[model samples]
Target: PGFDPAARPPAPPPAAAPPTAVEPEVTGGGSRLPLLLGGIALVLVAALVGVGWILLKQGGGAAAAGTGVLIVGGSPTGAKVVVNGTPAGELPYVDSSALVGSYEVRVEADGYEPYTQRVVVAPGETAKVTVALKPAAKATAKVLVVSEPLDAKVLLDGEVVKEGGPAPWQASDVEAGKEHEIVVQKPGYRDARFVWTPEPGEEKTFTARLAPALVRLRVESEPAGATVYLDGAKRGRTPLDLEQVDATKQHRLEIDGGRCYERWSSTLIFDERAERTVRATLERSPACATRGDRAPGKKRSSGTAPAPRPKRRGKGKLMLNMRGAWANVWIDGKDTGKQTPLINYELPAGTHRIELKLPDGRSTQLTVEIQPNETVKKTVPAP
Candidate 1:
């Protein structure tokens, strides 16, 4: 009874089941086929992450492209290839295909004098280097330069090379083309030689000329009447032949007054080639010749005459003689030594200032005023 009762009522309600007719099964394109398969699975995961991000951007653009290469070579050919300082050219080396670096290579050549190193090129490197340039060294010899008056000495093969003070005189590193043996001497001159050939690196020149020296002087005077002076000036009596002079030139001799003559001075320098002759004789003279007499280039008057009283045959005897030039004598002022050509002097009479010294320095002073017994002669000229 209970079952029938409920079934009858529920049976009617069960008919609502007809509402289940949901016919939405059109998979061909219905609902856009799940939105087109979920948009093709999101475009296949964004096309596989965009093909793995385009293969990682093509491997990072091939690692930023920077290869390296720097090959170099060398020899004599122009060679002038610097790196750090820049000028990178000339030379067998210059391929600096850089970008992987460590450079510092220099190679210069002229006669040859430059070569440095410090290279390193990696990153796909192709480095190979080689260099060698050396050939520049010289110092030859062939000298002969001198001076002293051969015009001043400046020869090549004959020796005496330079001494003109200033001129086109250059005796550089001789021997380039060697062949020397020059000689040039001077004094009164007269000494020359030749032979100077230079050609290796080339450089040689020459010239020489000299000759002059001859002398013969003589002077005599004693109580026989003294008077002679060479440097001091006076010629005529007492053999004198200064000939061509210049034996090195330097003479000043003197001897004056005679009663017993005794006053001499000498200074001579001559020996260019040798051969000299001189002689002067005179004696006794203590400064005697007082009676006032000044007329020979004049200039002598200092007052003082009265002190000569002792002597026999000539009271205060005095004598002197000289020839040519050959002196170095100063009396009354000391240094009484040196006189040639009849050399003789002696005084004890009065005033006197006889001095003669020559050899370049030059000197000649004479002032005589002897009394007692006098005799003087002079001649001097050579400085």
Candidate 2:
């Protein structure tokens, strides 16, 4: 058996030479166990990093856990809320991320009393505040008015108050915390106006001083009975007294003398409240003396010499004093160009028919005899 080894049934092809195992190739003299371990560690590290990024993006860090929430609600829904002396928000408000602390809460609304409270907030807990507001009480004030000059009328809010009374007037039950107009007025004085707002339940006294707006003026002339004019307007005859004249400005005073004297004028300013007088002296003017002269171009009649004229007679003075009415005087059926109260008028000595003619078409006739160089005073009655 030992000699025929090649032919001994081929020996089952040498037992088919069992399958051989092949090992993986390793570089740098390193083993695969260490590499596998490194790969597992890298995968674990990447998974951990991804988890950390997701947590940071969701705002779930340490800071978010310490904060609290706050909510405010009240009867008046729109009331303002102040926390710790700082404005927080309006009523029915919610603050999701408020810091945990103690706060002084104040709720306020118009026409309502303010509500105040103390509140505390805890971590991860919500603090809710509820308030019931009450209506505020209305207030009134009393005002006393005093004017410089007594007996001045007082007006409040464009309506007369305490009329027909003196100063130191009082007005009660005026609304407080609102603006009111006060006016003080009197005759012959400038009006005084003021705006006042009083506190609740306050009694206040106000003083108003008024300035005089008119001046008392008396006008006189050297000769009585002259016409007086003020600011180109006829005021009256001379020796006139005016109670109310415009003050603090310049005024023109004029005196006119008819047919005998020159006109007098003056510019005057009255600034004081006292009485003032204006006197004007008229000058005699010769221009009015030739008023009855003939025209310059008229010539005398061409005739023989006229007979000698009779001697001129002496003149007697007539004083006409009229009572209750002023009338025109007519002598011998001719107009005398004079009115009643004509003092010391000269006329020739003779018996003349005197007629008193009134403005209303009424007349009275009398027979008057004038004596030479003597004045006849007659008191004429109104017809």
Candidate 3:
């Protein structure tokens, strides 16, 4: 029967499709299809994730590998190297992908001069630098000692270097461009002095000849009681002198006070052939042992010269021989006569400064004290 449209819709609403065919329950195989399909999808997603992680790690490692490293080598390996002002690790310097930069590199080795270079390294590039080392400087010299009789002493500066030979001396492996002094000396010989400048890697020679010193000394002193010294070394007693000393030699002469003088010193000088006489007149020292009552240049007698008197023969011709000759017979500041021809002079007892002319034209004044009936005899030496 055909139902009305609205009524039929209500009636048919409950008509569930009958469990048409009650089939037997499927086992695990039925659920296995959907589960397996879902599992396959999950496995695919995990594999994709693992692949993506591996790709990411590989990319990071590649970026890290891009960096600049510097390598240095020399004829002598393992030399100390410096970069800029910093001390980089010894020879080969490595960095982790640094930016491009310019650097100054320095290399040093034992017994070699230091070498420096400017280097430009780009990013992701390795730099290789090479350097050649130069040897250090040295100086060598030969010395020839030359002198008369070959007895001179050799000195470097003020220190003694060698003594008494004609030997060959060598100075090796010294620093270059230095000034050195060479001095030679000997007893009775003048000093030989010179200077030398050396160059690097050069061999040089020098010659030196020492000359002799010849001088003389002469000294004298009055009252003759002091000792004399030469250059603080004792030579002799005063009234002391020497001869033929070195001409270029320097000396200091000193005298000591003992009798009538004070201590004094003199600088002696000479030429190639020089004779010099140095004299000292001793005055009465304040510490003199003996005191004098008489003054200097004071005569001890009055004036009246002794002479032979001539007279007529009363009993017998008065025969007499006077000891002194060329005597001036003076009576009160007036010349009476000379005693050479036996002059007659009447004189009274008195003191006198008897002036007698000597053979050498020197007039000697003698002090004479005449007493009554006393005849004094005196002998005169030639001037």
TM-score of each prediction? 0.34, 0.39, 0.35
TM-score of 1: 0.34
Which candidate comes out best when scored by TM-score? 2
lDDT of 2 by residue, 171-198 (tens): 6788899999999988878788889998
Q: What is every candidate's alpha-carbon RMSD to the true fold?
A: 19.2, 22.8, 27.0
- In model 3, state the lDDT of residue 50: 79
Residue 291 CA displacement from its true place in model 1, Å: 10
Worst 10 residues of 1 by lDDT: 56-65
Model 3's TM-score against the true structure: 0.35
Give candidate 1's whole-model lDDT. Answer: 0.56
Across residues 155-243, which tens digit of lDDT does each residue of candidate 3 receive? 77577877776664556654557787878778876676778776776666656555447645666665454677878988887666687
RMSD of 1: 19.2
1 versus 2: better TM-score goes to: 2
lDDT of 1 by residue, 1-383 (tens): 34565456443444455556677676654565678899999999999777755643433111223556676786877678877677878767646456555667778877676778877666676776678877777547534443334245555554545655634355668756556666665454556566666666554445444445555544433222345676787654444344555554577776555343455555666544445544433333444344443322234587885555544343343344434456667766787665544244666666556655555565555556566665565564443
